[model samples]
Target: MDPEGSRIQDDPYIQVMMAGSTLRKVKSRSWKKNRYFRLLEDGLTIWYKSRWAGRGHSTFSVTDLEAVREGHQSEVLLSIAEEFPAELCFTLVFHGRQGNLDLVAESPDEAQAWIQGVRKLIHKTQTMDEKERLDQWVLDWFHKADKNKDGKMNFKEVKKLLKMMNVEMNEDHALHLFTMADKSESGSLEIEQFVFFYKMLTQRDEVWKVFQDYSEDGEKLMLEELESFLSVEQHEGEQSTQHAQELIECYEPSETAKKQGAMSLDGFQMYLCSQEGSIFKPEHQDLYQDMSQPLSHYFISSSHNTYLLEDQLRGQSSLEAYIQALKRGCRCVEVDCWDGYDEDPVVYHGHTLTSKILFKDVISTLKEYAFRASEFPVILSIENHCSVEQQKVMAQYLRQILGDMLQTTLLDGQVPQQLPSPQELKGKILLKAKKIGGLEEYLDETCTDEVSDEEEMANCDAEMASTEDSPEKKSKAKSKMSRELSDLVVYCKSVHFGGFEHARSHAKCYEISSFSESKAKKLAKEAGTDFVQYNTRQLSRTYPSGLRTDSSNYNPQDMWSMGCQIVALNFQTAGLEMDLNDGLFRQNGCCGYVIKPDFMRDGNTQFSPDKPEEREGYKPLRLSIQVISGQQLPKVNQKEGSIVDPLVRVEIHGVPQDQAKDETSHINNNGFNPVWNETLDFTIHTPELALVRFVVEDYDKASRNDFIGQYTLPFTCIQPGYRHIHLLSKDGTAIPPSSLFVNISISELT
Candidate 1:
């Protein structure tokens, strides 16, 4: 079961990849050069080099790759398809915001070999368990330290390895351990010996102490003793005996220990680091939330300016951005459509330097990937800046590309009293756009020519956004709308929001409103209860302010607190805001729709984000987290001889009253095995609405602290016990073996 063992011994594709091939790396139409690309011996990295850059090789791990798409799937690859055959080209799609690498092989066979080989490697990486990942991580470091390619290391190399792993060990102690590991009287230690030495050097004394507290003997724990540990430390309660038995049978490495109903230290550690031992509840990892509720009752995962890859201004607009957003479980994607060349429509940020993407191409991409991550309905939030003619073209593209997946008519052939549930609208694309009149009137008329003040204001505001004119002045301007495009609006009709009071009396359940971040925050603060009540009846979207030209995102939790169904954030931006959004939607199978808390969904219920104490059944929680230790943390600066002084911070984002953070003291000169053993506590007034974020940063006395890694999950998902918090990179990809060991306990505030 070794991660790097003889698993791929018979795989011909992998063998060919290891042999290497010269491929034409295509960056653009004209920039194509031959490069020698090969998979590293470890089978986890791809190394490539050009003759132009002598002795300078670059490598990327298989873990960094998101997918391997065959043929001309990328824009760069598509540009060169006229010269290169489809079978001879492939794309390496990297995770996060990394640009995709398009490559063309010498022959079709070489292309297929790389594609299949990379696919196999990706599958292996994805399917690896936590323990396997840890072993592979250790092996990777071993490969790095064995610089001479001898598969053996001497005391000198071992000492250097210690420093590389962020451990500044005493020379005497290091040599003593090295000698102890070299049992064969050999001057150099092999891989096995190196692993033994690593175990000795990085022993978890804290875990051993906890094991000693429960075990009658230092070596093993009997069934009853194991049950006691589960109940007392893990809070397993009545299920402790069963859970203990399961852990022993599953994680016990020794057959003798399993037969004797005894758990060894290895078994205990394995159980502690397994998925069952994770900080988040394993039961909540799937679609466990109620999805049958009306669409307005759920906080739908959404994206603002989905066409842009970077900042709104001067950012390249691409169809890949739409695909990425959809694949990340973003149900609602905003497309700012403007007039394009050749009587077609384009999507881009209006009045900015952002590049344009074909509206048809975006639709095709949406059709292909809309339900790939989540089967919930996708909302195409159209910010139309197109002329009436191009708008018609846009509508035609939507129908042609999306086909039956597009919901062009009302459900059950009638307008609903309330919006349909996500379950009912699954696998469908609903257009959120302006229409000529009400749903009934639009349904009856073939082409109604009307000048609606709401549609006029929306169109004018979008076109004249750069102007310093007020809302009143923006409303005075008018624009024409094509009936063909207007007919596509079914459930989600875009309308101008006049105030909470006006909405209470005039807004229909089928009608929706979009608010800028500033206005939404104002509404949430000035009239929280009304905002929540309004959302319970009608869908409301809160987007980033226009001033965020750099495509920064606002705190989505603030809008979410007021039960805004679509709190859109710039999906292209990566920060605390996107982290919070990902954390909230990470649960319920990441289906992009999370059911709002009970009070927030009930129109009659008077609940405000500012006054969680006044809500019915409000039970405050006392959360205690002991920041025990960190393991194999990444260096902030990946340079030789650099080490991080890491610190842990736990933040709770929710209602203003529940929002808080606490941090442990910094552990200097240690990124690996830095032990804090400090407890941080918080009182969450609204536990269901709260998100807990665990952040590791490199502490600095001078300047700002450098971010190491972070993990954020819903507060309700926090499991009470000794758990391992696996850290993720800023882009939300797993950084295996880099984790925090913590003890979490949550109880009702008495």
Candidate 2:
């Protein structure tokens, strides 16, 4: 099927977009101006420019855009709603950190036309297969290089196109390939001829050599040979024979090859680039983990200060941040509630310049998106700072807005020794706040009527009570918690942490504790075995320290290694910490929960991150990775006539003894097809807790290296044999065809 729709000419919206229209581009209320916008013939780019500015235009690819929102859904459009009707306004949301574009059409029809048209384009781009996307990318570049309105490109234009594509080719070799592709001898190449030239330039000699090593003949692989390859190289075991037949049927390009039960070079390469050939195992791509275990026996995806979009000090608090976090499979989210105008409660970081958002609006947003990505229960961690009156209002919004989605009662009306599983509590939102009393105390209504100021303020983090303020001043700010709010806390009740032994004796399964990053690290280092044991039966959340005013995150791998269930991170920040968080939750259907390793889930098991070798049945594994080559890597500098000198680094993040990093030598002046063939090996003491990160950077000797792309996955998910590690941008979005081709081998260390 044609990914851009089987029939593009029949759509009216696409037709209107092709014809173009005038829109009022809005950056702010006073910056709105008229601009002419149109979709180019390639159907992958949108160009717009000021009607009065001569020869100055801008263009953005359809692939760069994430979605198009109708009406005034964005903050920029909402700020100007009084000047324009909602129907006449729209917003274009780009991928990653790119700012959104707000536009107002002259009429509602025009607004709807652009909105629906761009949405269709996005859907088509998403549906394109890897091979189809590569072909479209090549064609897009061909169009960019055509220069004139003509449908062909001359040798000079082709040479310029090579630079644009991040390729620094030798003049003689480039001329030879271009002349050979231009078989018509017209001194100019058409689109088809350009594609031929691209193929000749990107021929994978490394892959060809590996293929020749297995094939009886140089051209193709027989059925038995393919089976042997899968068994020996891919570690397919007894299933290799069946997998071989499936590969031949799926990837074999020639009908004759399929009939003869063989695979040609093109077929073999296709098989290698397919999802089956990727580093992550195909089985682990789905929901393979055990979700029926107790809730405490899982590593839950969590976010700290979920309302903030930027720095905690002065960033904007937005409802969209909650929606973004939930959509990214965050099972736990924190909201700090304080008093607001009109006797309502607002969420924001206290003692900071951050903006505030209504508590009711946040609840509404959570209700709409809490289960959109994962059906597992969501824990709403409330840091309450409201007065008694506003606390009542906040409780009312939780019940009214969330309706039946809120888990306000004990499951089966009975308090069990252990908490419920995620599968059992699906489609419910659990409130993690201060409760007046225990579950047994709730049986008597009179005993659980009121919460003291100390109990109420215990849910607040250390930052909430600033050291600059005197004790008397801080006491004056504290307020009592209303009974309505205290009653809403069901499973996840927050309490102050005592010693590990105290928790084991007095803590209930329904109660949880929150620790600052520094405090948690101290406890983990002092009593690692006790921390792991406590987490087996009860949940514990670890959040960033109060000093992280910039909203930075600590390494979550440290907490996960010790069985910390809710290691909340600043979801607004994008870095190695966020990358590892995303990588850990990318498995098990991204349901926001992954079952803890067996030792961590066992109450009596002795497993410490500091002493992994002492664990029962401990067997270390030796991992070997061969960095073969790179393909179509992006250039860091956008300057003209510039190329990147790229290098690949492989890092293992896990137990301290297993932590290691190795890199390949830099390949100068080449971001395309740089061959390393360097093998880096490591001995992993605890493979279950290990994460492997492959990073590609523009190497610089005098200064820090510039990031190109990276990919991280669990060490257990790494598939053996030849594989393609598809790279991602700094913001965690896929940069297709920009990948590292490598071979992997794993075995038990002697």
Candidate 3:
């Protein structure tokens, strides 16, 4: 049979077991009706088919000889010689009697041992329920010859179901088994692609033994390994969608402080009470009454109680003591005009005010306290102590009695007038203007006689030949003759005339107040006026003398460094007691206190308190004492002598003259270097003496003393150490005892 059809074309299970024995040898002569069968057990192989339509030929038909004698005959010939142990050849065929049978084998377990020797010759005459219905018709013919149903039977769907069991498929193998079980181009088969194409063709070698046991170690089956093979249904829905996007970006709240109620609570308690002492005690008074829920605005006066309610509304009137000190929270108030006759503006305070207080009874008590020109805005400093034409007729009757709420200036460019004329009203009503004698009378009336004396000696020989060929136009003609003598000495001291040719013909109007550089280099060398009007102690006595006590060219390491806005102080003499470590007063500049309020009381009290009060009652005395300036005093040294019983003895022979055993032997002396004098001496007792105490054992304990004021010591004293002495008194008594020896030398003074 052509060598058994070339051993069934070299084995696709021996070409499906010799094409099912050539369709059962042409099923009884040219296949009376197709019917083919092959089955093998153990080393598996199964094939079967049946069909009938025309052709007639019926011989061995006793149910086809009892299904070829008992279907899967003896379980496929006793497992085909124990599963085809190896060598086996093949050849077999049958036909004509309306039955078919064929067999051929070489390998494939000898074509499954010749289809298990023809199912052991049809199991010696079938039975066992007809061999379990022919083993489920050969396991549904190998599960319909699996296409891409990836279980195992691979050989291209067993050569397309053996050409549809010889029906011969065409249309390109039925479009390659309808797109090979449709691997997703969605044409069909998706029951997991028909159970992976029937387990890869009936478990092809158990589909490579479960893909080499889950791809052995070269790992890769992703989508998180098919989502851990669908473990716990996709990790709890990806952790509940990442915790709902972190609760929508944590706690919302920011749309511009929620539409400007600026997070309420009365605008955060007025921004925490504008900071300074931020009031809110009593254990945070329930967190300041829950952050002041409704209180809107109320700073209730500060800046030193608003300058003491503007100095008690300048000598009281119906400010009813400044509206009772602004209901106890006072804020600046002062006022005090004069010029009255009918020209109105009255108020009060010294300089012959025979009786005043009008300005319409202080604008009818600020219009009966409805006080709202934007909520109590009344800053009236005013003081015009009299004369510059009666203070411009009391600043035009206080601008016709507070018109435009009296912010001052009677005319000429209206308000903003700080003194060019309106005569010096000491109590300060702002009026500035006079800056340094109006450029020393505009360079003595513009170089007086307009440069005569031979054109000022030919313009000083053409400024010494243009200062070496125009040194910047000889410094712009000496800065235009020192800015025309510093603007004519600040326009003759702003109308208070006097110099600069008596304010260049009786000052009509002038103002300027600064510019000096030594009066502008002496008004560019005497070409004219040199108006002056100093003050910071006459500008520190016109500076230039080693720069007037050069405090190392004045820097002093920012002295005490804070916001130094002080502004005035000079108290050097005029009744000197002001103590606080007496440097008179200037550390960090501009401090005041020149006492003598009759030497500050207490010489047997009597109604004193000129301000500082409130002690144990409710805070407010604000006492910070310590002043010290008169150029930091200290410089005495010791001279005017004449010692008699003056005192300065120290001969302590192993001490012990009781002053508590010489102050406990000078506090348990050790290597005795209490600064100065040497070994020993004693004899200090001084009753109503006069001040002569000295003690120095280890004097070079590096120099100290720089003394300056505060002194006291005439009695009780003691101290003993190495020693020193030298007073003199036995009888001479010149003057060394009216308390003379005043050495005071404690260094550091700048």
Candidate 4:
């Protein structure tokens, strides 16, 4: 052993090497037991044995020692206690053989010197590129200094470093240094850290006091105290949330409306006004008042009376039930009509045995019930369930009774001449052609009659053809001809069919026309008729079309554009009951409904209730909706003669309100306005409701607006899930349903 090695004994952890088998003996207070260490081949290999066990316990290869000494071995065993006294017993071994090696000292000055040493050594090793070597050097120094391995330099380490430099620091000053040095958590301080900390110390009185009062003997702060302080702050935030919820639940009436049921309209208005961050203005109050008006002009009287016309004959159809339904606010009604024995029109769904009740009877009944000219212009869709002759007779009777009130091509003054025989009519409803020869002949005769006699004769000879011939030839010729004839008389009206292409080749042609299920909707839109008769199957196929062709298959807007009123035929009471029970009536685009009386009596099915006296309403549901604009606003000073443009309106029904009256609850808040040209967001406030309905209308001519769509917003006051909702409109209403929900969860930490 070298003589100078004996002085290491005083350090209490020195090992003495021995010759013969290359063994060592260690003596120290920390190592109580005798420890053997061996050096073989002139210190080329070293080994140690536990003297108590008399066995070789650990060994060290000199080759590795040489490598580490040469800076080739990446691992650098660091004594953590030198920097962090709290981690005195721990030692961190860094992998230095992989790349650059770093040694972290207690002070920032020492750390800078250590980093410089690492940079110089790495540049000499050629183990990494210039950029990579710099990065490795910085990372290694940070890792050595991060005693807690939290990737941050804390106060204790900084204070210890200052003490070594003969500079004292109080806890606060140490903490400030820790904060400034560890801006990004990595323990080692950068060039900016020293400058920032020094500047802060010079500028702040607190920092200077902390530096002057620094003491190593001062008591260490307990970890529990730090954690408790953080917890208290977080708890206060949670309490605030609970308090807000309580406030909403225990809301009190404002002082302005304390005397009026505690919830007067004025109070509601105030509440709406108090809502800041909203776009609604006070001027929109009228819009809300207007929204309270009835969404539809017609109401079904005796909504629960399924047997209103069970025993009435086809001609003696009574409007007593219809009137009651209207009083209840049904805008549309179903009236069955049949032909009498003498070709008179009668109102009944089934065949009539007597002709006592003429179509005039029903007309008069309607006139009495209607009362005012514009109060409630109800649409009475007549379902033709009897023969074609019966329907034609009924139509004719209706024309005579209704006169101008009846909306038809004839009423519009579009007739070319006198009505044609029923048998000669084709497409849509069966009617007699007043002037035919189709388009070709009509055009020729009407336009050529003014020509000179010579020109007229020349054209007549070339155009003249046989009028009477074999039945097959006549039928074929008739099929090809597209003009009106001079002598043909009215016979039977033709029934329109959706599959007319197929029916023309198979089914016998009739004088009366019935609508085909396939084309009924398209034809109705084009004709602008208020009443359309369709087979039950077609009517039952209430799949939406046009609006969302990608899914709904039907667009209410398209239907509204077509002037035809929709009616379902062959509907049994059971089917109607099913529809009502399933909330089918709530679908948009449906104007009126029809069902055979016999179906109503089969099982005593009743109409669902409309008011509180009725059964519970269906669950609230949402509809996926899309809105479309039908017309553009007129420019300034534009012509006023044209019909006024319609404004979109929405009315919700079946919501539980404070009042028990059968009045509508208008959502007049700016949140419901469609003119904003942006989405209006709001919540529906109601409790345990039976049914939810949406009615849309225009403000100018309220009665003339169409029911573009309807939907039910499902009723679940407090829940976590998705619910679809649709917008409602009477005429040209285009807003789609807005989806809403509440999230009750903590924000995620990045």
Best lDDT among the predictions, by candidate number: 2
Expressed as tens digits, the lDDT of each residue in 1-750 for candidate 4 is 122223422222112222312211212122223344444322223455666675548654322221211111111222222333321111111221111122223334333332332233323333433223233333433444445666444555545434322233466756866676567766555535643543343232321222223212222112232123223322223344443233222332344323221332222222212311011122321212111111111111112111132322332233434443443233334454444667665554343342234565656555554433123234444333334455445545556655554433332233232222211221112122212223224224464213343332222210011122223322222221112211121222222232434433442221223232334454443432222112111111111211221121222212212211232221112221222222322222121221222211122222121222232232223321122122112111123222222233322333222112121222221121222121222223222322223233323334544233333322221121111223322211223222111111112122
Q: Whole-model lDDT for model 2 versus the true structure?
A: 0.88
Worst 10 residues of 2 by lDDT: 461-470
lDDT of each: 0.86, 0.88, 0.26, 0.29
Report the error of model 3 at residue 65, Å.
99
Off by over 4 Å in 2: 1-6, 28-31, 454-478
TM-score of 2: 0.96
lDDT tens per residue, model 3, 1-750: 123323434556434544444232221122223344444331233445544525533222112221222221221222243433223322232221111232223345544544554454344223323223333333444555655555445445545543433222345654565468666665555344544443333222321332233332322222232223223321224543333222112211333433321222222212212211111111221211111110011111211111111222232233333333333222224444545675555665333213345655554444333242123233232333333344445434444544454323233433212222211211212222122223324333433313333322222312122222325323322221122212212212222213345434443332211221243234323422122111100110011112222111121101101101111111111111111111212111111111111111112222111111211221211111111001101113322221111111221111012121111122111110111111222232211111222221211223642221222211112111101121111111111101111111111112
Clashing pairs in 1: none
Rank candidates by TM-score, best first: 1, 2, 4, 3
The regions of model 4 sitting more than 4 angstroms off are: 1-317, 325-335, 338-345, 351-358, 370-400, 408-494, 498-750
Clashes of each: 0, 0, 94, 86
Candidate 4: lDDT of 476?
24
Q: lDDT score, residue 161, model 4?
A: 38
Encode model 1's per-residue lDDT on 1-750: one tens digit a residue. Answer: 263546773589999999999999988898999999998888898999996787899999999998999998987888788899899999899988788888999998889999999999899988987667767887898899987989999878887788788876678998999999999979889988888888887789888989999998799999999999999998888988888899998888899999999999888888887888889889888999887889999999999989999997899998889888998999999888888999988888767788887888889889989999999999999887678889889989988889899998877887788999999999999999877777867557654554565556653322234243245325334667788888888888877777778878877898888788787887777888898899899998888877788999889999999889898998989889999999999999999998988988898979988988998898888999999999989888878788899999999999999889999999878888999999999999999899999999999999999999999999988889899998999888788778899999998888
Cα TM-score per model: 0.97, 0.96, 0.15, 0.25
Comparing 2 with 4 on TM-score, the higher-scoring candidate is 2
In TM-score terms, which candidate is top? Answer: 1
Question: Sorted on lDDT, highest at the top, how do the candidates line up?
Answer: 2, 1, 4, 3
Angstrom error at residue 607, model 2: 0.9
